[model samples]
Structures are given as structure tokens and as C-alpha cells.
Target: MGRGWRGAAARRTCNPRGPCCRVAGDARRPSRPRLSRSLSRRLTVPETLPSVPWRGPRHGRRVGTDPRRGPQRRRFVTLAALLALTVSALSASAPFDLASSGSDVAVEVPDPAPVATPEPEPEVEAPLVVPAATPVRVLIPAIGVDAPIEVYTDAMVAAADGWIDPTTHDVVSWWQGGGTPSSDPDNTVYLYGHVSRLEAVFNYLHSVVPGTEVTVVTEAGEIVYVVQEVLEPVGKEALPDDPRINAQVPGRLVLIGCYREPDQGRRRTTHNIVVIAHQVDSAK
Candidate 1:
């Protein structure tokens, strides 16, 4: 027989002794078959194989090895690449100012300009006013006396102290040193006349009652005064020192004249009469 016949007979032969018995008539088992070159190459593990962390069983699948994990793994890699590119682009576009952040460098910010404040207006003082009017005429309606007035200056005569000796009885005399007829309440205008002289301007002045209105005309205009008082007769000797006859007190108008007593006769004048009035109205 050929080798094939021998192999067939070997397979068919049985040992009379059990499987562990080595009997004299037993057929030897055929030698183990050897793999072919191609098959061996396919089964052999490569020495240059890439290293991989060992995972058990199902977890041992490499990235993209499973059909479900293939697309997911590719998307993850793509997203990572895009995120890196975005970060790099942002960093390049907006660079930090490293030089200004240094410890030795100083940054300056300008102060705001001050607001313009307007200055306050200056205070202005009023001008001082000096009155310039002088009495030109006198009128006492209650006594029916109206006469022109003349400013009698004491400096006109070397020996005269503003006292006038009337040459004519038709005119009245005003002292230049006395106050002018004005709106000033503290000032008093003085007028002097003689009742003892013939046809005197103040001949009927003693007859003027307390309620009479007196008008004194000046270059400015007429000033009206209501009689406030008819003073008692003052002796002629005490006339110079009498405060009633002077312009020192608060009076608008004052009329002074020699007083004649009915018992003392008309020609003999021992005392003087004073009439005081206050300004009521004026027309300028």
C-alpha cells in the first residue's frame, strides 16, 4: 500500500488495551500537521506593533474601530482643531499691552478743566444831593400878608450878623444862613419882618390863627405849610438866644416879628412873636 493506505489503516486500527495502554499491536498516531507559510504568517503577532493601553473585552476597541464610534471620534477631532484655531486667532487679533503694564512705566490721566464762575456785580453808591433853592416870596393868607422876599446875607456888611433893618415895609427878609424851604424835615426856613414899622409886611401876622396855611414861593416852586404853632411873645432882649426864633430845631417854616401889646401901645414894641409851620405839600 501507499502512504494514503497506511494513513487510512492507522485511523481505523484500535488498541485492545485501553487508551492509556501501550499494546504491542497498537498503530502509532500520525504526527501533528504543520501550518503552511501563508497561514503561519497570518497568525503570527508582529514585533513592530503599535503600543496600546490594555482594556478588557468590549472596552478594548480602538478609536474608530466600532461603526458607531467612527463618526463621533472624527467629529471630536475636528471640533478640537477648530477650537485651537479660534483661540489662536483671537490671541493674535487682540494683543495685550505688555510695555504699559511694566512696574517702571507710569500712565497719566489729565484732570478736567475748571468750570468758569461768573463774578458778582460791583456795588454802586448813590450820588449826594445838595438843595439849591432860596426863598423869593412869602404869603400868609390868614393875616392877609403877601410880600416879596430878599436873601439877607450877614457878609454883605462888615458889622452886620445877618440882621436886617428894613428900608421898606412892603418886602420881607430871609436869612441866608437859615435852611431853604425843602422836603428835609430836620431843616427850618426862617423869615423876619417888622410889625412896628409903617405899613410893615407882617403888620397883621399876630392876627394869624393856629390853623392858617402859609405859602412860601421859591425859584423852584411854591411850598405849602400849615401853621402848627403861634408861640408866646418872647422879650426882644432874649430873642438872640431863643431856640424858637432860630433854625436849629425841626421846623419847616418860621416867622419872627416884633410883637405890640394893646396896652403897650402900637409904637412901643418890647417883645417878639414867632409863628411855626410845617410843610404839608409842595409843587415843583
Candidate 2:
């Protein structure tokens, strides 16, 4: 065999898939040999190579990695290990909150959902009316005048045809359109009587002095009122317009009665008296 063939055959026996080998100068001294510099450069081989444990073709279950793929496998394993360590640290630690100061890393956090607002309630206003109790009788003790209360419609109290004699002789007429004594305080209790020649009803109305107590018996209860003022010499048409009578509607009692003899010529009542009173005690 040729000398080069003998050396190449020996190298194949030693390393089947590894590196190239050099021929020793002497066979007796077993000196360390190296790959040729030109061959190593041409093959792009590393300076140091791992030793192969076996001398034959690898059949089953290779002990180590392939030399060609070793560097890539090692790099992949290292990267995987670093990734595992970073994931473990992130999961085990608390949440990350960035500072106002500048940073290279950015963490995304979603905003919370918006809260719903409730609308305000509307304001309610109080009504100006209340349940009313119809008055049935009125008694003025100072004048010894105890009379039945008569509710009159607007047209009746107006007496366009003139005040009826029998209707006003011994009875008191209540203007139903006005206030009820026991109801809303703002309503004015208007009661009036005609002057009778028998001196029965309002014939003595002029004698009813101030501070006199008047009692009103209603279907609801008894309401007591004290005389606050008396307006005399009032005309029948302007009697209701008096400031004292108009001002006291709430819990007030107003009494109207014709004064002096009727004018036979004019066929009309000449003078009238008006009494204004306020509630002193509430009915039980």
C-alpha cells in the first residue's frame, strides 16, 4: 500500500466522522500530530475537536450531539433556560407598576369600565286645596243670634233681583264660593244676614262689639273665632272690598248685615256693617 493510504486508513479507524489527522515523522516515537494548516483552513474546522468514543458508524441511540449541529443546539438550550427564568420571575413577583420617570420597557394595563350615574329625583309642589267641612249653624252669644247657616250659590248671594226677604229674615247665608272655616287657612268665611224688622237675626248686628266670641258649628266640628275688627257704614257693593275683610281669608269669619232703614225711594239697602274675626281655637 502507499504511505498516504496507510495514514488516511489509520485516521479513519481512529475518528470516523470527526477531524483530519497528520502523519507522524517516526513510527517508533509516537509523537503528537496535527491537522495540516491549509486543510483546516479549507475545511473551516475548529482548533480543538471533541473526541469520538466509538470507531464505527453510529447505529442506534447516539451518546452525544452531532458536531455539525452542536453549536445551534447549545445556543437554543441557553436561550430556553433564560426565557424560563424570566417567566418564573414575572409570575412569582407582584404586578409591575411603572414610575413617572422614563423607562425602556412598557407594560400594558387596561382601564376599568366606566361607572353609571343615577339621575336626580324631581321636586313636587304642595297643592293649595284641602278637604272642606260645610258649616251648618252660627251663634253669636253677645247678640243672642243663633241661626241656621244657608249655603248660597254665586248668583244667589249676588241677589241681582234684590235680597230675598224670607231667605235672609232669620237665617245667615254663606257665600259658598269663599273659604270654609275648618278647611285651608287661606279661605275666608263669609256670612251675612239681612236686617229684619222683628229684631231677630242681624237687627242687633251693630251692637256686636270687638273681642266678642263667635262660634261656628260645622259638619266636621265646632270652630270658635274672636272678633278682630268691625267695619260700619260700608256700601253693599263695596263692603266685600274692604282691606280688613279681604286681608283675613284664612281662618277668618266675616259678618255682613244691612244697617239703617232701607231706602224706600232707591229700593236698596243704604248702609251695611262688616265684622272680621280670626280663629282663636281649633275644633276638636
The models' CA-based lDDT, in order, is: 0.74, 0.73
lDDT of 2 by residue, 134-215 (tens): 8889999998989998887777746745442337588888877778877455678888887755555888888877899998
TM-score of 2: 0.48
lDDT of 1 by residue, 1-284 (tens): 69976566555444667575443324565555799999999999988989899876775677656798777888999999999897676555544443444433345759999999999889865422324478888888777888899877767433454345555678788877677876553577778887864577888888888779998888767778889889899887887788666647644788888887766654677788888888776655
lDDT of 2: 0.73
Clashes of 2: 1
Model 2 residue pairs with clashes: 185-250
RMSD of each: 15.9, 17.9
